[model samples]
Target: MARHLRAFLGADDATLARRLTAAGTVQAVLDAIRTRLSEPARDALVAELTAATGGLLEEDLDSILLSGLLGYHGLVDAARQTAAEQDMTNLVTLDHHLVRVTSEPVVEVLVDRQQAYELRLALTVTFTVQGLAATVRAGRLVHVRIGRCSADVSLSWAGQALVRHSDLVDAPLVIKLGSGVPVHEITDPADDPALARGTARVPGPRVAQPGS
Candidate 1:
């Protein structure tokens, strides 16, 4: 299970997390994010706000109010981006050191499936489903065995099947496998095929600050 624990760090992941977490309330974080928007974005937001308020917009808008609206907009954009990443089956972040959502989705799905398998295995070990079962053993999902009472006898043999799926694989060296393994890689849309895709897109995470 420890091996399964992985984290992804895009640009400002630490700072963004800290800012968001340290805030006393969610509203505070939203306000901080509003000030980070570009001038054009800010003006557009103001215009949008004016339209929503039906021309009675305050001559002097409250900064906190304005930021609350802007922060909502930013969160909306972030959600859209997250959805796009899922649709693309990729989450490309700048830091190569951290596991990209793109890279981990496949493995994550595999680990999740194990939970399902564990439930089925429990039924197989006992004729009746009673009590609780733990999928992980000794901080590792491998060789997981679980049962209580009569089920314990069956688990001794049946629960040995669960094991962690390995992510490693050989490409340049293969034996009777499919050719051109497709070396799945990420690239920004702006990057040309001839150029390294890695060099094209910048990665950064959003950080909101406390209310100004």
Candidate 2:
């Protein structure tokens, strides 16, 4: 009877025949069937089979085997959805109208010993207005701004503060300038010890000898 149902569900004909021919394969076939069914269907089938057989079984049984298969399917679907969302979120359209200038050899400066020097950098940015208006370039500087700094600096694009720099002198003297852009300038003082640790340090205040 189960063999007929297995055939109706498209189970391989040879495999079904082999299972039906062996008494030891019956339990294995039943386990395989339960794993392929969804939760509701599995429950319904289990109820029908148990009632028909009058609750005769030789070992403990659990729904976990079926539930695990469904769980595996659910996980696969969730992973696909997350990957799709990530792809959509990361999609960026390039703007082909802006000219960008990047300066290399990011400058490092030290202000003084014990106190780190803080600098406010200002960039005189020039854009080829003609290129942007015509969309002739492959890159666009959609916006320009300064990141955090230890000291405050007044910024102007033709006199406007696109971005403000703050917190330059804080601990961890290193500062990251901007996101997805290059830094134009970094200012540091000449007397910084971290910058000149290899140089000799001047002697501290000397006390006159009592004998002298």
Query: How high a TM-score does candidate 2 get?
Result: 0.15
Query: Model 2 has how many clashing residue pairs?
Result: 8
Question: Residues 1-212, candidate 2, lDDT per residue (tens digit)?
Answer: 11121122222434323322233322332453333444554344333322221111111111111111122222234334444453321212222222222111111112122212111222221122111111101121112221211222221222333222322222222212122111111112112333212211112223469998
lDDT value, candidate 1, whole model: 0.21
Once superposed on the true structure, which residue ranges of model 1 sit more than 4 Å away at CA? 4-19, 23-27, 30-180, 184-212
RMSD, every candidate, angstroms? 26.5, 36.4
Which candidate number has the best lDDT? 2
Given candidate 1, what's the lDDT at residue 87?
32
Pairs of residues clashing in candidate 2: 149-166, 149-167, 149-168, 150-167, 150-168, 150-169, 156-160, 157-160
lDDT (0 to 1) per candidate: 0.21, 0.24
